[model samples]
Target: MIRGVRGATTIEKDEPEIIFSEITKLVQEIVTANNIQPEDISSVVISTTTDIKSAFPAKAVRSLEGWQYVPTMCTHEIDVPGALPMCMRVLMHVNTEVHQKDIQHIYLNNAVSLRPDLVK
Candidate 1:
């Protein structure tokens, strides 16, 4: 069956280096948490708040070893007043045998507020 893994993180700034580093950390955490291999991922969809425009988070995911073949896309999150800033989110579709209820969703840094219920 196909399952979706969700993750979110915040960057200190919109600089390319920061965006790259934070996204890399977020994706790595998700992969590690889920015990997912690159080949298991079908696609990764990433989005960032309006304040983040220095780089696309998907670019950082693509930089991961063995992830070049995974389908990925990036987009802008809806601008909402009072929303968290510098937030990057990812939805990874994976072909796996894991049950939906057992899938782990990661929320890191300031983005943890976005899903307090899912925080471990």
Candidate 2:
């Protein structure tokens, strides 16, 4: 079965280094929480708030060890007024037998507020 593992995180600034670091941390946690292998992931789609323009989050995912071939794309979230700023969200599609309700969804830093119901 294919499962979608969701995750989100926030960075304080738009600097490339910060974007890379936080995004890397977010994806890593998603995989760890879901017990997913890099090869098991079909694709990763990342959307960042408009305030984040320093880098593409896909770069950080592709740079991971054994993740070079994983397909990834980056885009901007809808620019809603008063929406969370400096946020990056990830939806990773993985081939796994885990049931939908059992799958883990991670939200870290300020992004934790984005989905409090999903946070455990």
Candidate 3:
């Protein structure tokens, strides 16, 4: 079955290195939490808040070994009033046998407030 693993993290600044590091950390945590291998990932869709324009989060994912073959896309999130800044989110589509309700969703840093119920 196809399962979706969601994750979000906030960067300290809009610089490329900060964005890359935060995104990579977020994706790494999601993969580790779900026990998912890169080969099992069908696709990854990443979005950054409007304030983040320094780099594409998908580029960070591509830096991972074996992840270059995984289909990935990056886009900008809609700017909303009072929305968190410097935020990057990802939806990873993976072929897994795990039950939907059991899937782990990660939210880190200030982004954790976006999904208080999912934080652990």
List runs of model 1 lying over 4 Å from the truth. none
Query: How accurate locally is residue 99 in candidate 3, as Cα lDDT from 0 to 100?
Result: 99
Candidate 3, 1-120: lDDT as tens digits:
999999999988899999888989999999999999999999999999999997888988997998989999999999999999889999999999999989999999999999998998
- TM-scores vs. true structure, each candidate: 0.97, 0.98, 0.97
Candidate 1, residues 16-109, lDDT tens digits: the string is 9999999999999999999999999989999999999988778878989999999999999999999999899999999999999899999999
Evaluation by TM-score, superior candidate among 2 and 3:
2
What local lDDT score does residue 13 receive in model 1, on the 0 to 100 scale? 80
Q: Report the number of the highest-lDDT candidate.
A: 2
Top-TM-score candidate index: 2
lDDT of each: 0.93, 0.94, 0.93
Candidate 2 residues 1-120, lDDT tens each?
888899999998899999999999999899999999999999999999999997899998999999999999999999999999999999999999999999999999999899999999
Over 4 Å off, model 3: none
TM-score computed on alpha carbons, candidate 1: 0.97
Q: Which ten residues in a row have the lowest lDDT in candidate 3?
A: 54-63
lDDT (0-100) at residue 43 of candidate 1?
Answer: 91
